[model samples]
Target: MKTLLRTLLIPALALITLGAIYFLSAFLGMIIPVGPEKEEYPKEVEIFVHTNGLHADFVLPTTHEVHDWKDVLEGKHFGEFETPYLSIGWGEKNFYLNTPTMADLTAPTLVKALFLPSTSAMHVDYMYGKPREGDHASSIWISEQMYLELVDYILGTFELEDGKAILIDHDGYYDYDQFYRAKGKYHAFWTCNNWTNRGLKKIGLRNSLWTPMDWGVFYYLEK
Candidate 1:
C-alpha cells in the first residue's frame, strides 16, 4: 500500500503543479494588453421621435466594451430569454430589424428603432462571396413575427423591380442598381437558413419576441 501511494502521489503533484502554471499563464494572458482593443461603440436605450417628418433619431448608449454577447445579455436581467434576431450594421449600416407599417405603430407617421453599430457587426470580416457554414455575417436569428413583418413590408412597400428589392448592404455602399442585384443574389442568406426562419414559421406571431443578437442596435420607426 505504501509503495503504491508513493507512486501515485508523484504524478498527482505534477498534475497539480502543471494546472497551477496553466491557470497563472491564462490569467496573465487576459491582463497583458495584446493589440489595441476595439473600443465598445456607443448605443442607445431609448429613442425619440421628433415631430418633424424625418425618421426618428436613435440615442447612443454608453461607450462600454464587453467580452461577449453573454456579458451584454446577463447585464440586462432578462437572462432567461434568447434573442431571436441577429444583424450587423456596416459603416452606416442599415437593415430592417422588425417590420414597419402605418398601423400597430405608435408614432403619428412611422417610427422604427434601429439598434446599430453593435459589437457583433464589428466582429465580422467579409468578402463578396457565399458565406461559409460558420459565417457569422450570413446568419441572422430573428423571431418569427419580426421576420414575417419584415417580409410583408419588403413585399408591400418596395416594388421589386427586376426581381429584387432595395436592400441595405455594407452601409448601402453600392448604388441603387448594385444594392438591388445583391439582394436578389443573397436573399436566402439574409432571410432563410438555420433554425431561424424555420423556428419563426413554427411559432407564428405578428411581432414575435425578436431581439437583436446585440440587442443594442435599433432605430425607432415612429418615434
Candidate 2:
C-alpha cells in the first residue's frame, strides 16, 4: 500500500513541475526579443489653425453656456468667437444655428457679427461667410477655397474616416436621427462647438476625463 501511494505521488509531482516550467517559458517569451519588430508611439493630429500657425490646445470645460445660433448670428456674444469652442453633451432636441439665406441680423451684441460679416472682407454666403449645404444641423460656412484646403489637410494629416475626424453634417444640433449619416467623413460642418470638441479630442482628450484649465473671457473682431 505504501509503495502504491509513493508511485502516485511521484507522477503527480513530476506533472506539476513540468506545468510550472511550461508557464515560465511562455512568460519569458513575452519579455525576451526573438524576432524583428517595430516600436510604436501615440499619434497626435492637429485640428485648429491660427493665422500665424499657432495651435491653441483644445481643452474642454466642465460646463458652458449653450449657444443660440440665431442669436449668435443676430450679433450676440456667443462666448468667445475668435477661437472655436467645443462641447460633448448629447442634445435632446434640434437647435437653430443658421438660416438658409442671408438676412440682416440685429441684436444688442450685433457688432460681434462683424467678425463673420457677409459683405465685407469675406463674402458671407452662409453665416460666418461660409458655404451652407442646406442642412440646418450643418450650420457652417467656409470659403469654398478654405473648405477644400481643410479637407485635403485633414485627410493627409491623419487617417480620418476612422482614425481622427468624423463628419458632423446630420440631424438637429445634437445627436439625432440623422447623426449616423454623417459618420466616417471630415470637416463639412463648422460650429465653434464642433471645432473645439474635435480639436481637444484630437489632442488626446477622452470623453470622460477631467483636465486642468484657465478660464478667461475675451472679445475680438473677426477679419
| Candidate 2 weakest ten by summed lDDT | 212-221
Instruction: Give the TM-score comparing model 1 with the true structure, all chains together.
Output: 0.21
> What would the TM-score be for candidate 2 when compared with the true structure?
0.18
lDDT of 2 at 190: 24
Error of 2 at 197 (Å): 33
Give the alpha-carbon lDDT of every model.
0.26, 0.26
Tell me the spans in candidate 2 whose CA falls farther than 4 Å from its real position. Answer: 34-223
Prediction 2 global C-alpha lDDT: 0.26
